[model samples]
Target: MTLHRTAILCLTLTAGAASAEQLADLHLNIVPRTDAEAARIASVIAPTTDFTQPEKFEDNSAGAATVRPRANADAFSQASGNMSFERELDFKLGNGLFKKLWVSSPSSTLASDGLGPLYNARSCQRCHLKDGRGHPPETADDSAVSLLIRVSVPAPTAAEIEGYFATMPDPTYGGQIQDFGIAGHPAEATVNVTYSEEAVALSDGEVAHLRTPTFTLTNPGYGAFRDDLMISPRIAPQMIGLGLLEAIPAADILANADPDDADGDGISGKAQIVMSAVYDQPMLGRFGLKAGKPSIWEQSAGAFAGDIGISTTLHPAGYGDCTEAQTACRTAPDGATEVHDNAEIGDDGLTLVTFYSQNLGVPARRDLNNTQVLRGKQVFYETGCIDCHTPKHVTHRLEDQPEQSFQLIWPYSDLLLHDMGPGLADKRPDGRADGQEWRTPPLWGIGLTQQVSGHSNFLHDGRARSLLEAVLWHGGEAAPHRQAVIDMPKPDRDALIRFLESL
Candidate 1:
């Protein structure tokens, strides 16, 4: 049986423990259903619905703007000169000077431009290989290639919020901490975790136990950091169909926000509305956990500046932390924002890189027609997993490609925040999201993750070791679905997991 069987039993026992008077007031379905009756019971467990259907996007503002072909027409001609220009542009973006500027070329000097004083990885491709999924560490001592770094403001108490600043102060380490440095300087910091034991009683009268994580920083390279400072760690997410997501109109997203559960479905899909500093407008955020930033342009610019300490048009200032001991780092020239317009290296490099990221195609589905897959899909929906993991969404047309227009896509995510319960909470506030909430991660290309990322870790911090573990770890809003999954027969449970692998 799955881990949830115990949870169901616990609930039953708690329900049974009420006082006689309280029990009299309670309603119960005491008789067990027969096999035919069980099938009827299962029928009520609705198939996972595709929440990304047409109705979800009908109200979007940009929904009315039909995707058009690229503004650059001459580039698509079959002429040799056009082909050559295309190749040249690709070369420039992929491996030329532009690549050197946007991506850190390990062999180049920091002073030569584009390399970093502080960085997580040297290149964009390092974390997101070929724009594919990033796996977590398989073993504790393993070198972390693709990892998520989280950032947050410390949660303010009511008293502090009333007396001082309206919001929590930003950390000295701007958003993220770049642990590795160029050859000369010491690395920024190191993270280590120690676990404490915890126990819980299961319905089978057995104790299923686990460990709790406690984090500590060693050799505080920066000195006396605040104990109550906010911290966020996030793994790099796959980059596919981001442009299509951006094309989705804000109205469509807002239409799905039923924050008060007005639909009475017991599931409230809320929207995280954020102010886009780049666009200078309140936009529906579809990216990031809190959906704080708007477009990929802003996301990329912020990553370059915050992750690598490299400045671009959007972020003019380099990372601003300094100590007397790190004199060389303090002396490095901060990159100017308008370097693209004025310096030899212009925005040409950054633009092409962004294009490549935005255009990385989602691979075609592999096992849709298989019997096991078909059955699994049925099981997935029947178990009510589809309530949140909505299956299909149609992409808006790409202006550049007539062939790629209006394609029906399947990215299994609702892109809404759900309370994930205390087990997953980092206890920090980000934008409009509380500590316990997280965006639903899309489940496309998940089957290929083990092959591409070379690890099985899942979830925000890579805590779950397998898909089963990931499901078992779900709580809060997912508790009901998790229970249903546990109560399923062994064959059906296996079928459901097989269905996930076929993704």
Candidate 2:
């Protein structure tokens, strides 16, 4: 295995597996970025540094994959700068699978067939649009392709909580509320999202109008949903530096956890621990809005089965999440067969897609040194947003995984769950995350969302229209931080936003 060693970082040999626009368990490490010469990278590599006392200086290479700087509509598509030639070929193949549109079952195109009897989108790239985050529909008539609802009910104590996560999938409608079905089959329901705005006056008399969304299940093509069902909405997140996020050591993440707020910081970050079939034990959930998934592989496989209705080894059900209630839908012809061992998406296809997700480059910070951006960075720290959104992480040194190997990264997230308060709550629980708890999402490629996805709507449910709105909505553990920002002068507020834009 080939490894890239450097003065400030060590990139493990990127063998495979891994992302947003994230993967089935793309378990990858990251390399470091640097302006230093090749001789430095090839010889006299430094040992890993203590994350507790992390380096204060912002080096050019903010860890390998977490910091690639591309400023264009196609910014999110670039692979890591130091990717090996061999892996670049794999990245391209993975890109093909990532962008490959799946057709309905029993199609002539076998490699790309077996779309859902019920599904939200045809391809991964469609929802992730240019490998960036997705947004909510602008109007009720607009397509909800990128945004989907998760339906569930309070789970009885007798219900399984291990491998099969908590919450009961709607018996008739299934776990996900799919609005689009295959040619003849009717969709489960149409998602009608309406919002009522409330003005929040800041200390400076600046008002931030917050739009709270109400999702109504309209035009139920199937049977009526359970009377007591609960629904949660989610938008696809950007695909950048996922491998590096995955490589962060569990201890380092856990070290930052203050589940009980013992330090009097008011910021209690709880790690989302869920049952993992990949490691055959409980592991920290690192992907998804709630961090309900343990690895990118499981996350990708879940998306294949849930989002696209394409079954994989992880989710072998040929019915594509269709419950017994939907009998005909379950009985419909499937893409899986005796040859593929009842998997709609074969291992090879899953592998290719995972590889592509594992290596999506982290766009370099555009204006890290700018005056306003720097001030905003200081403001961000002062406001305590960095408490849950922890700034730096070093990827673990896994064997043959140098691309995301031991290197410093600045994803600006702790990957821990925090109570975001009632304003952003979905009133539905996922794993251990209550309705109001959400994983601190990474802020690496956010400033480029508009360049790639054409919209900047944010938060798990896409209610926050801008970064400021997103911050203003922070409550529970982050309420004090939000208040600090609200109390800032206009120039400071603008500087804070400018700093966020620099990410």
Candidate 3:
């Protein structure tokens, strides 16, 4: 194998079956770090202990790629700070495609036709508003632009069941219930959510209310679902520092995977392995709420097909997610043309969008030196949140991706799957993630949710109304950490939240 000696060392340090060959396949585009470079990286990424002051470069969350934080809703919409002028044009062009709305096919808009026989949103920007996080519908009249309900059934055949990764899409409705459709086609279903509130008393006589949401599909366009149908609700996550996340060596991510919790830290973060859509090999899952997609390219292509019903080279079905049972949808006219590589959003278009997504720079950290923020940072570290919300990672030196190359980034995620317990469970397995398992989402830019997205709803389904509520919802591996917050004095709890907000 052509694996670097340092990479081999990194792999041997981890407990997994990932051979050097598999890692080499994933790092094809990256240059192997030299022994000297590896040593420097080890020292750089080590967790800091000096809480009296902010660590070196703590405010630059994405290193050279970090953009200046904006004062308005466009804070999350900037390109990489390190991107070149020539590349910025491509980013702008990609932004245009990302925001472009598609109409129904058989219209005069040949270049932009093929709006989906069934879809949840018309454009990427529609769901991921202002490049920020998405929220669930706020009221009965609110449109479900960002939040989507996913539907799948248990593997039917014995062989499929034994295969274990064989969770199948619904026969008639397909993988997701698209709430919107083109002019003539009917939508798959209407997603209905009702919440019940429970109040918990914390230390120092403070109370926090948590909302438990029950989701159901009403007004099904296609007939009834299977008896064993499983469903999950997902909201669009924030778009920033994706290229940096992708550049984190798979060996580094795997090294954090303690599937059995052998050391007994009560936190076992398991790697989610999925077959790569582009490379056609088992790769570390990194994007999506459950870390289902392996790369941003695949993730972007998937959203194009699943969210907007626009086909790309990766997902060539012009009818989008229409199942064989939906004859009218399958027969609908698509925007495929020979000039655009026979897909609505061709390879070039998809590439541009992916480029835009990969370069969306994370905003610089705020209030790092604030006394409360610093105290909260100490509280956060002592509380053992770093076990899963790993504070730092160094990206590989990529010959192509200059912006994300060899930089220490603070995404505050292990990118590993952990069981969040029944309280947060959707009971729907996604690839390697069980019902209760969710990828530890990157906490960077979370403080700006209200500033950028105009709301602060969070978690996989937007059930959490505030950062405190989001923490209270943590369970399973994070239950002890959550209890720490609940039991800590109110000052420390407030500081912990302040420290989180500074991120």
Task: Name the candidate that leads on lDDT.
Answer: 3
Worst 10 residues of 3 by lDDT: 1-10
The TM-score that candidate 1 achieves is 0.72
The 10-residue segment with the lowest total lDDT in model 1: 1-10
* Per-residue lDDT of candidate 3, residues 284-309 (tens digit): 77889998877888888888888889
lDDT of 2 by residue, 343-418 (tens): 8877776776776787788777776657777777777777777887777666666666667777767788989889
What C-alpha lDDT, on a 0 to 100 scale, does residue 223 get in candidate 1? 60
Positional deviation of 159 in candidate 3, in angstroms?
8.1
**Tens-place lDDT digits, model 1, residues 203-319:** 334333444555444555556557666666566776655554654333334445566777777666665545454544344456765554556666766666655656655655443
Runs of candidate 1 with Cα error greater than 4 angstroms are: 1-112, 135-140, 155-171, 194-213, 320-330, 334-339, 342-345, 397-404
Q: What is the model-wide C-alpha lDDT for candidate 1?
A: 0.52
> Against the hidden true structure, what lDDT does model 2 obtain?
0.75
Could you arrange the candidates by TM-score from highest to lowest? 3, 2, 1
Q: Which stretches of candidate 3 lie over 4 Å from their true place?
A: 1-22, 157-165
